[model samples]
Target: MTEAAELPPAPQQAEAVFGDRFPEAVRYGELLADAGVRRGLIGPREVPRLWERHLLNCAVLSEAVPEGVSVCDVGSGAGLPGIPLALVRPDLRITLLEPLLRRTNFLEEVVELLGLDHVMVVRGRAEEVLGKLPPVHVVTARAVAPLDRLAGWGVPLLRPYGEMLALKGDTAEEELKGARAALSKLGVVESSVFHVGEGVVDPPSTVVRVEVGESPGGVRFAAKRAKAARTGRARRRR
Candidate 1:
């Protein structure tokens, strides 16, 4: 059994912890369990940790995400954060962008099975797709890439005032430091980190929220040209 299952049943405890958000969390938990069963992604014994590690881990970031915003979850595999976020915040429109064909298919099925109309799945890499779309209010990611690469993927898709919320492990601070150069290249100027629950897992989780800022003339012009060149190459290869 997963670690989460070994612990005592926490349904009531979870409800008290989440308050009004409990019902949705529980329902989504069921959906995740069902999806895992149908896809054989996890053994029946593994559902509990999947619920806690994947679902709740992502759900807590909802506290960091601002309300009434359009957000995109980059490289969303199996729709962890995006799907759970849609369940909790019915008002926020979430787009899940996945590059792999099979994963994208899985995401679509999960959304349909869960009756999540607020979630949309796009098939493409973030670097290729993010620039084409209009900037969104916020971007989220989990286990997709390192902080530096994630910043590169997310910054281009964010409005000047938009935010990027990344679910990371204990090395979040170190990753943020490593990502400083990349962030500057992408026009992200400020960042904040928040630690989530303790003792749920080793090397506990944190959320890194990055804020986009105005790029200087030379930097902005250079970034635009670089993006254009990259897009051109991608189309040529296609």
Candidate 2:
């Protein structure tokens, strides 16, 4: 096997972004460089720029999240925004949701090693967990899928008035424009594109924020939720 590339030192901005959890951030970076590459969760080429492109890029997402809210990171491959967000914000409860077993295993280990009591690793696709997992205040994703398709998976898992934050690149605005109709169908009352990280990271991270109203996943999801509630009531009676 090829040797893993060296993880670059955390940029000076990381200290300010991660605050007291800076050490944990460094440890996470090391793991991403080492184990993350070995397991094919992340490419070896990504190791050298892990801090600037990955960690800090995701960590600054915390600025867009509300205080003391629950968040689910969909398709949390290698736990990008979820783990980094957890490192910075202890107050926010985070669930790292990944469909693959190998990736979930890595996330579980990282959570344990970091002692991130606030973070949970769940293995399942976003559609599969819709009714099984409680809806959260916010759903986060990065490089998962197209904006419309991704909204279909992430929006239904949110509580009323919750938002879906997607970390995109230059195509953020373009995707939002293309997905506007799909977003409307998913009960997205408002949608926009914005950037985070500013001085913390050059160019900053572009994000597509999709906010839902009272009916988070639209009409069909409401019916599904009602059915699930009834099923739960029946089970309780049994």
Candidate 3:
């Protein structure tokens, strides 16, 4: 059993949406409010509204997930969207992919404390871990990068035709429009904005959904890939 820490009361929004799952969700919230703050992953001021803003904001994205599939949360700092996702969807196999040791340590502990057997803590950036990581049906992220750059890192890690569901703020549509050129080259077949969690979370949650092509793959790092391509061309001529 996970030890409980002092926590703000679970937001009514959480109970309203999560229903019976509310208790377990609340436990996870307590864990985040304490450890996540002490570790600097969550700002101390966020503790009061953590349930509404952080946990619920992330959890509501579950509305976009198809049932029973593998999910990888890239750059899963403090396990946003990832940990909450695992807590809500016991069926999903979630990988919390984080490059930082301190954050991964917190993620691993949270998984252990919450007894989330379905969640895996992977410590590495998407660029370094893509080839080594198993291709998953969905790649989740929040505060990761702009649409174009995120595709560069995420598309290669997905199963062919899989999707990248990025939690963008209000700029989702604008970002999608701006990324068309990059998306074409990065194997993105479709890109759109989705508003999920209607009644559960106020204002709903905005997600940028990018679907990869049937044979999808892309550069791991933009600058590095460009340099490598130029070098190859120069070497061929020489």
Candidate 4:
């Protein structure tokens, strides 16, 4: 691990990105750089870029979301995008879904510190939490996985017309090209690349937006097989 970097107050430009939510956003950034790194949810080296690369990158995702709908942040490590979005959009209810206990503990602490009554943290994989969470209008993630696999996790969490807004960075188009077969199998419609926050952040945030259910069926992985595969992969990785 690199030398620990200090968590910063929201940079001056945070006001430009988050407006009145600047203070809370900064506080969240500080916690993420500090506790999040200490707990291994974030790397120590990422501290310097937390504000620009993580918080703002996630906050700007709000630009793609329609107003007044519930959202779930899939694999929400350190509450990127989810907590920031909630801070800015009181109209939306946000859930932070993560499978790891350490990440969830940190998220819960941050949620309470931020007084984010609207956000809840669930400690479970997306597959494990099905039927346990309310269907949300949008599902979101950042750096989670390839689109094909991410869609397998996210598409099932959406309401009939709900969408998955996966932040794919520079590979957005390439991932989209690769995910056609997966999206088709998953019953998604209108999958496209959306570049949000063009002026708010340099280079903008790239998102692959896909609506679930083309003909009354949403995308679903073979649950039992997926779970088994995930378990084997984890064991091997360990």
Candidate 5:
């Protein structure tokens, strides 16, 4: 396993990862890396990990996103998978949904700095924002939430037959077990897990793809909101 201390700085490695062909992607990564450094979002020693572990890990989602499709990235802190995907596939329209004011501000600045016209940022929680937006062909997340909860949040915004691409670590099996009940309740029937970057230095990761069906109605929405609000309040109090 690559220690966080041994990782390359985000800017240098991101440039190497994107190469010359994708100028915009490279610029976006550079800007985000700089911002991360300024905000102390990641430790200096962890720079290399940001590239191999964070950026490249997120970029792998590109293979699963179909061509000329719309994607929504929930809880898109610093626009990891979404920005990288948008950079690679200009054809795919990406909406980054981030509730935190600070992160959204940073993402908007990064988008402008990179001149990414294909992306948009939404400032609200997924549960509140998913209903208002058009159904997207794909929904993606990285370390945002657990499998079942993420599916519940994602399914409502997904077009029928649309898929959820969730990035997970080695504990994927345990998470899947815990999420089974929640998955069934959300109408996500077929779920499969794929291992990616097996030979890489970092611990292997998995992509759990869940097929979304119709969303639960208004009552369910309200209940979810109430629970989320209570959880947030608790966290704040703590």
Candidate 6:
């Protein structure tokens, strides 16, 4: 078998970004470089730039998140923004949602090893877990899908007046523009494109922010949540 790729040192900016949790961040980087690549969760080529492209890139997303809120990271394959965000912002409760069991196992291990009690791992698609999981104040994603389709999965999991922070690349604005109608249908009241990690990272990470009003996930999802709540109450009484 070939040798495992080495994890690069964390950039100086990482300490400032992750604050007191810098050591945990380094461990997470190590895990991604070794186990993450071996497990095929991330490519070996990504190891050299793991700290910059993955950890730091995702940790900076904490700037856009609110002071204290619940966040759901949809399609959280290797816990990009979820784990990093948890490291930086312990004030926020995070749920890393991944459909694949292998990925979920990785996430649960990371959460446990890193002592990220504020973070939880759930194995299921966003749509499938809609009623089972409580709606969150924010949903974060990275390289998951196109803006329109990602919104379909992420938006419905949000609570009223919550927002989705998607980490996109140069195509952020273009995708936001193209997804206008779909966002509207998903109860997205406002949407825009912005950048985070300004001087910390080279070009900065582009983000597509989609905000929803009272009825998140639209009319159908509202009905589903209501029914789920009723079912839970009946089960408790039984």
- The TM-score ranking, best first, is 2, 6, 4, 3, 5, 1
- Tell me the TM-score of model 4: 0.89
C-alpha RMSD (angstroms) for model 3: 4.6
Question: Candidate 6: minimum summed lDDT over ten consecutive residues — where?
Answer: 217-226
Instruction: For residues 124-228, write the lDDT of model 4, one tens digit per residue.
Output: 988878777887899999899999889888887788888999988788899999999888777787789878878767778888999876452442454655678
| Candidate 3 lDDT over residue span 112-228, tens digit each | 878899999999988778567789999999998998888888877888879999999988989999998988887788888989888777788899999987887464344468678
What tens-digit string does per-residue lDDT give for candidate 6 at 22-136? Answer: 9999899888888898888999888998888888889889889999999999999999888989999999999999999999999999999999989999999887787799889
Candidate 6, TM-score vs. the true structure?
0.91
Best by lDDT: 2
Q: State the RMSD for candidate 5.
A: 5.4
lDDT of 1 at 121: 92
- Candidate 5 TM-score to native: 0.79
Arrange candidates by lDDT, highest first: which order? 2, 6, 3, 4, 5, 1
lDDT of 1 by residue, 166-206 (tens): 99887898999888877776677688788764543334468
Give residue 47's lDDT in candidate 6 (0 to 100).
Answer: 92
Tens-place lDDT per residue, model 5, 1-238, is 2222333334444554455535666555555556665665445554645667677777767767789999999889878778877776788899999998888888898888777799999999877775578878899999888887777777677777788889988878788888877776666767888865554325555788888655533226545766888999999999
Model 4 deviation from the true structure expressed as Cα RMSD, one decimal place: 3.7
Model 2 clash pairs are none
The TM-score of predicted model 1 comes to: 0.77
- Per-model clash counts, in order, read 0, 0, 0, 1, 4, 0
Error of 4 at 138 (Å): 0.3
All candidates' TM-scores?
0.77, 0.91, 0.88, 0.89, 0.79, 0.91
Any runs in candidate 1 off by more than 4 Å, and if so which?
1-10, 16-46, 197-204, 215-238
Off by over 4 Å in 6: 1-3, 217-238
